[model samples]
Target chain A: MRRLTDVGALREAYDLVIVGAGPAGMAAAVEAAGQDRAVLVLDENPGPGGQIYRAIGTAPLRDPRVLGAAYWEGAALADAFAAAEVDYLPGATVWHLDDALEIGVSAGARSAVLPARRVILATGALERPMPLRGWTLPGVMSVGAGQALLKAQGIAPTGRVVLAGCGPLLWLYAAQCIAAGAAPSLILETTPRANWRGALRHLPAFLATPYARKGLALMARVRRHLRVVPHVAALAIDAEDGALRVTWAEGTAFTADHVLLHQGVVPTLNLARAAGCAIAWDEGNACFAPVTDAWGTASLPGIAVAGDGAGIAGAEAAALRGRLTALEALRALGVLDEAGRDARAAPHRAALARWSRGRAFLDALYRPAPHFCAAPPDAMACRCEEVTGAALRDAARMGATGPNQLKAFLRCGMGPCQGRMCGPTITETIAQERGIHPREVGYMRLRTPAKPITLGEFAALRKTEADRRAVERR
Target chain B: MFRRLPEPPARRIGFSLDGVAVQGAEGDTVAAALLALGRTACRETAVSGAPRGPYCMMGVCFDCLVVIDGLGNRQGCLVPLREGMVVETQHGRRDAAR
Candidate 1:
């Protein structure tokens, strides 16, 4: 793991600048460079594997079937990056992108600029936070954060954690937590076991991956140590006497030292939005994802988005997308002949088809419960504005049937967290109140600087852009 | 079967939750203390009047919203408890004419 302290200052123009060094970015970097084009990968972490292949600090766990395959695949991608002589800028957060393919990146306290002919965004996704009461307690954390804590720091959030939420990640994290000896007190799965019947319909693809089968076995074993509460939702949590008093919808209550919550993932599309890429709402994931072609090319001619940035697919699909994207970029650059592009992309297309089946199955199995948006009048629907469900419903009753109208009245989507968590609920509440489908509600409009930017950086960028405009006018 | 433990003897602060005097911890959030007190029905739904409580403890779910200090809708989970925080139960969307 090489950490470049000053990547911005060490600038040579690359043929392609890939922001993110996870499964997709790394694969793209390797394949792009293999065509003898200079490829550079910038990542915010100390190492690759954005989240899924998160560095398992300890030795590979005994069960190599579950998360081990992803780990090994990440390791192989790292090796491939090394062999391809791709310039890797680790611990660098690419914060800004201009239409001219100019990128601004920050590494800790320092910053740099990298200009490239092509840019591929594979920024991946972040776990969706489902805010409920008592969620702000110290013992509460996202399932991804819990796994990251164990993998990155070798420390469990708490010994007797309660793993709650929906999705395969909940089970996967539960198994890992148990294996790490932090065994959760209970596993509250909002997704019912009946959902697995739908997942079973995709058994043909599941049977193909031996590692996935192993993951299932490990989950089964972990179930023995943990009380599996399927089709149950954590209604509330209250901290009492240094312990979390948790309530479920089924009239069951439990106490635990910590609570790990998961609600699947939403595509990390801040960079995509900043780059002016067109985004489409993905109803299945309850989030907006950048619209990308089969080859991961975005609406922009020179820019492409791959992996979770394009949509939320796991590591295997991300890797496949990455390779396919590279072939497309090569074709666009006029470097790859038609036959060459076909040969490189054919196998990936087949792998993607198989990988997508599992993702689709998981998506159906883990779709958020219908009652999630049914907030009570007093229940907070917008954490940012403290907008209550009552307030939202009143607005809807007043003929405010979309997020924008609701936002105008209540300021629900205008907050520091940027409505990533509350947007869907707010939209749904408005839809429910107006007796309309959620799809009828308009989506939140995204502006530049998708994330919070420092005042200093904003000022500097403003000055630079103003100066450039002045020069252009002259 | 886990037994519910007795409340700890921490310094309790009194606060008004929707005109109800509730006692909570000094460091506890308004939502946490409210949930601990068994006040599960935080508010009524704007359309259906469905009772809702805290769902996601972290600031993500937006399920534990209550009006604090006259602010119509605030995330109770994210708000820290003060000695005399005035929290009101949000009944429906803020614009609903009472």
Candidate 2:
């Protein structure tokens, strides 16, 4: 595998270019590489495994049980990707993506334009906006950030740390903390009420499936030592006496050096939306996702999305989907005829079906905390601009229809996160205030340069004198 | 305050934080290095001048912005800390800071 850095080194065109080196992107790369298609995988991180399998390359984690058996399985995937024929571009930020499969990337001080016949976006997910009182305080953090700290460098809160909100990842991190011989001061779980009435329909499917057993086991392990508080209605973080004072609806309060917050995760949809893909609101996960078919095809013919980027179907299902997408791409490229592609896709599809059966249950079971639907008036909705829920509600009253209009009225999604940290919260607030469906309200319209790029990096994109001339003419 | 088990930081990677020599481990990012040193406030708000630290170590929150080796507005969590690397707490927007 070749590592590309210079903009001058990128091939004029790739048969397939995959954005994100996560489970889906790398799995797709491995499959496409085996099929002899010229492939390229780009990631902002230094390694291949995405959030779920972070640090798989460098970490030979001394104890697999520390992170868990599911995480340890990523080692084989990384090894397979390492041995594959795909070209990997690490530390490369794919900021801009067009409908024609052209990708604008910034690597170090350099920039490059990658033109691809077909593009697969495995762009992954981001934590849903968790806006509570005093969250802007210095010590508050997302649970994902804590887990990343542990994964990247084995860092954990040595002092009193309170873990709040709900998600399997939160419990998994709690279990990891317990395994590492440390425990949180408290676990404030805003666990969603189980929709047993609506969920009975999916019971047969979940019973026959082995999904969420890992989550259950992690919860079991965490309950042994940590004091778990379930179903926190009102939550707030305040800086009191040099520590984060966490208070919930029932008035239970605790002070810790650090307060970690999480709701769940939503799709990273900047690339897909910028590529003009049709995004539909996923009712199950209570978030927006690019409307993608079984084979990972988006609304556009040449563009596809996989993994958490397409929807929130954990890691195992993402790998299967990556394989399915590669097969479909091969068939589209005329390399594998229809029958060959179908035969290859059959097993992957079946595996995805079994994995997906458990997915709906988790999505419904862990739907974001109810308060998000109508957050308190003063809660911070946008972390970047510091827009409050009250501000969003004011805009909604002024006939601001959706996220796009709110962006003009209050500058909600125009910050560095590019709406990732604020989109869900604003959408929920506006929808609730207007008494409409979140789907009808829609999400922020994303643009190019998804991540920040320095002007110097932009100038470096002119790789040649002809490019310089073209820029001058423009 | 946070250290990995069964390993004593492997080896020290020294860097400068606002002209002071700071010792960081090989695997530590600039933000992690700062955190390890108990320096919680990364920068002050442009509007309020209120101190803010690295909330989300994952590059989503832009709160971790710091000047790395004269390159301002770099995400401390995104860039890996290296020996002799100079980093300063970013004051405001890069242009305004300049």
Candidate 3:
């Protein structure tokens, strides 16, 4: 693998372009390069291992046990990707991807457009926004942010800490913090007690899966080491005495130096949405995912959505799905026949089936409470624009029907982060306000230059007549 | 709000945060380095001037916006910590002159 340093180093085109260097992107690169397809992988990070295995190659932690087995497993995939014949560019962000396979990417203060025959989006997931009061404070960050700090830089919160919200990741991060000698002061679990009844039907599959044992063990460890409050129905954080005070049920609160929150993760849909792939609201996951077939093929030909970007499957499943998408790409590119593709995909398919066994149970068990998902009127929804839920609700009442219209009315989704922090909440809040499904509310219509780019970078790009005509003064 | 664990020492890079020189280890992102120094709230929001810091170190949230080496509106979490860098807190909007 050759690491390209700048936009000028990239070729004019390639056989395949994979966005995101996570497990899915790396796995797909390994597969496609083995098939002798010219591949280019663009990643926004300084290294490989997109979020889940983040900093696997360059982790500051010396003890392998600190990060656990699942994280270390990514090293092998990274090694395989390193050995493959592919062009990998770190610190390169793909800002634009369209149906015709045109990619606008920027690296080192420069931008370039590259065309490819096939594209695979391994864009991965973002932590779901839990917009409670004071969530936008300086010391309050996502639990994933805390984990990323530990993994990449070997740092953890020093003073009193609190871990709040539902989902397996919250516990995993707590265990990691304990390993790092920064055990949290409290764990406020917000998993609704009623969810147990909904998740019970999938319990058999949960027990049969490997996650059951590992999850239970980790949960037990976290519970044993930390002060835990279960069935927490309400939560809020406020600034007091130059520190954060996290409040919950019946005015009970913990004075904390930092509050790390996580409920769950949802697929990052901007690139996929900008690419014009058909998307549908997933009831089980409670987020919109790109509509894709079994082979990870999206509605548009030559475009495939793989990994958690298609849906919120775990890392192993993402790798398997990556391989499946590579096989589909190979078949589409005429490098392999359909029968050959299926034959090569059999093992991955079987493994994926096993990996996805208990997902329904997890989804049902940890589905964030409605109050967490739909921000209350007083709480802020759009952190970038500082738009409140009440503002969005009022806009919805005043003739703004959907996210796009709400953007014009209130600028809810028109911020630097480009609706990522507020899109889901906006959709859910509008649906609840209008008495309709979130699907009917839909997502914001994202357009190119999805990520912020400098005017200098834009000017550096080779221009076409259409661009010239559009910008030229008549 | 954060503290660095005892690990094998790496080379320290010196940079200034709002004109005060601070030391960070090699390979640390600006956000991580700032957090390690307990310097949270890198910048105030452009909308409300409310104090904000890096929320998502993975670059999804724009709360980490800091002025680095005279370039405004840069994502501190995305940019690496280089030696002799000048990092400052961005007040409201980016200066048009910058």
Candidate 4:
């Protein structure tokens, strides 16, 4: 049942369909299929590893140290997934899902619609958008993207590279780049100095976790080889004379070949939001995530969101959460009794708690600067639609209050990315302009066909007679 | 924009970039191959025609959209490079015809 050859080879329905083949999805599939349930997993990447463990199975880098020991750990999960009696499909894009539990998928220039009794969305996280001036310039990219390049293809940033923004991931990536022999020349850290006071309250709990030690060692390793700038108040990038000019700290600037930026990662929310899950702003993580219960049940009856898509817990917690959610699903489906589910989930719950320890401290410490979140009037707010912060602000002032309204007024979130790149920024910008909380401003209203599919791919869908009659002209 | 590490021993795969022949390692995605080849700007925006490149490397950002073998708006970062594939810099909105 592993490795679907193409979309055409899919079954009409399954007991459970898990979207994304990252740690969470893989773990969930392993847990469910071990109970002999009909399970299927769909992933958009070329291989099983999602972004965090990108190319874990087929990474070009022979030396595991280049991507770190944590990334290499994905190998065991991927191997277990391969051994599990679960249908695994890579390069299969799930574009649409509905309350009926139907999933629309595109693969290899064709499309298919499949139904499932239950669905687990482990769609994982995306790099938080940093909408600085010239952010869309050729040489500018997110630090996560740079790490993906190195992990997936053994490519490293050439020439004078500059790493910027806050979060433990920034330092971890800098360390990886240094290990790859392409150490960045400088790092511009935007973590507010005042955050230390807020984060220190959680230091006792954080010290008990492995993250505290790992993070310290990683940062120390990076600092020895790179110039680290702390508490950067302002940052901007512009293409000047064919080079990227990065400016921060009161007009101080550096001309660089590449500018890698990152504040942190947030859940990839489009699929869940479009599928009608209730979403709320996570003040701790500074992002919007699906509202899920402890077992990962969303508002919808048959849908569950696991892993980072449910919240911003990292990979270890994601896998544990996945197993717990699968147990819940098994209980709901009569495969496991309530007592059985609870008994099986006990150890996973304990491990999840252990892995999730000190997350509060990390979130408090690495919350993106407000200025970076809202950006200035001149900075590009929507990379896809070319909408600027000023345009969004003006739209808000002119009575376009919500993201849905802003879409009509300025088409801010109507581009190919479907607001994924601009959703948070748009929410924050509107909230700032109207002097309201981001929750009040809300997020872009998303429709199905979450990722873009060519009209040709749509044409390949298996339409029912009712569907044809609904669209047919008299 | 990027350089290759000394190892990995990938088989060479050839593809066309804007009608020019280019070669990259076998496992490289189209965006990775383009960056490895030192071509920074991959496409012009459909909104304002400003040049953009692979910003996310993951498929989230559409900035790396390129034309592949007559198909327009294909995400270069998502698609793997193949031998003799036609890869063109997508300019503005995709042309309906190849």
TM-score of chain B of each: 0.83, 0.86, 0.92, 0.91
Q: Per-residue lDDT tens digits of candidate 1, residues B1-98?
A: 11112223446789997787888754456766775565654655454444555544333444566778876546675465788889887787543577
Collision count of model 1: 23
lDDT of each: 0.69, 0.81, 0.91, 0.90
Q: Tens-digit lDDT track for model 4 on A324-359?
A: 889998998789999999999999999998998999
The candidate 2 chain A region of ten consecutive residues with least summed lDDT is A192-201
- Model 2 lDDT per residue over A124-196, tens place: 8988878887877777878898888878787788788889888778888898888877678789888755545
Better of 1 and 2 by TM-score: 2
Native contacts present in candidate 1, fraction:
0.02
In model 4, the clashing pairs are none
**What pairs collide in candidate 2?**
none
Worst 10 residues of 1 chain B by lDDT: B1-10
* Better-scoring candidate (DockQ), 2 or 4: 4
Model 4 TM: 0.98
Q: What is the DockQ score, from 0 to 1, of model 1?
A: 0.04
Residue B2 alpha-carbon offset, candidate 4, angstroms:
1.0
Per-prediction fnat: 0.02, 0.63, 0.87, 0.87
Poorest lDDT segment (10 consecutive residues) of candidate 3 chain A:
A370-379
Candidate 3 residue-wise lDDT, A384-423, digit = tens? 9999989988988998999999899888878999988998
